[model samples]
Target: MRPLRNIFAAILLLSGAALWATARADDGAGRTPTPHPPRAQGEHCVADTDFMRRNHMKMMMAHRQDVLHEGVRTPQFNISGCVNCHAVKGDDGKPVSFASPQHFCRSCHTYAAVKIDCFECHNSRPETDGKAAATEIDGEDAARLAAFLRETKQ
Candidate 1:
């Protein structure tokens, strides 16, 4: 009986050691690298990479408040600049919209499990020939929207 108990204890210790080694091996073996989203197309960002990563939201919000409430617009901290510079190309060889996960903003936001509402009122894709597509509203769609608004008013 004593010999049997000793053997059982040795087997348990060896199994645990084997399991720990397997886990340690897995920690560095064939692990997928962390996702590194593309950065600005320009030579430099508006701010340093570390600073931008930490405080970009604050900067953009302050800029938004200034632009909307004070009528002050500057190139620094402009959201449009960020969108244009960080635009990622899709399979069609055109810039992807916010709907695509490959879009510059979506890559990090999806990884962080963060919801992005900025694109709700802002264009996710860069303009072509320096013209914005947001300025246009189809006549038929406009009429439908107007009708819907009038019905809801009643």
Candidate 2:
């Protein structure tokens, strides 16, 4: 009975050591890398990466109050601005959007098990894309875009 108990304890310790080693080697170092959004053509963001990671939700809340009560819609700290700039292409080359886990927002959000409701009404991608949206905007089209922003700001 004493021999059997010693063998069981040894096995348990070995198992734990193996598991710890594998966890540490995930990226060949003791530390795991943080998740980063896909690269954008522009090398800048509304804030530095560390600052944004810590304060993004707090910033969004203030942005919400400003947009709703004041109707102030500057580009900074806006969800639309982030989505447009951080948009990552999927395997099909179409933008990976909020609907998919591959989307920039959804990646870390889902990983952290936080549920987000921002995309319930908003389109995941921006209004403009290649050639079509890039082409010269007519007066009517520009007005429509403004109207769309106003309507969605609500």
- Kindly report which residue pairs in candidate 2 clash with one another: none
Highest lDDT: give the candidate number: 1
Per-model clash counts, in order, read: 0, 0
- lDDT scores in order: 0.75, 0.69
Q: In model 2, state the lDDT of residue 140.
A: 49
How close is every model to the real structure, measured as TM-score? 0.68, 0.65
Worst 10 residues of 1 by lDDT: 145-154
Residue by residue across 1-154, what tens digits does model 1's lDDT show? 9999999999999999999889978786544444578867898999899998888888988998999999998998887889889988877787766666577876676556566578658887787788754633346544643453344342
Query: For all the candidates, what are their Cα RMSDs to the real structure?
Result: 8.7, 9.6
Residue-level lDDT tens digits of model 2 in 96-122: 555555678766875565666676555
**Whole-model lDDT for model 1 versus the true structure?**
0.75
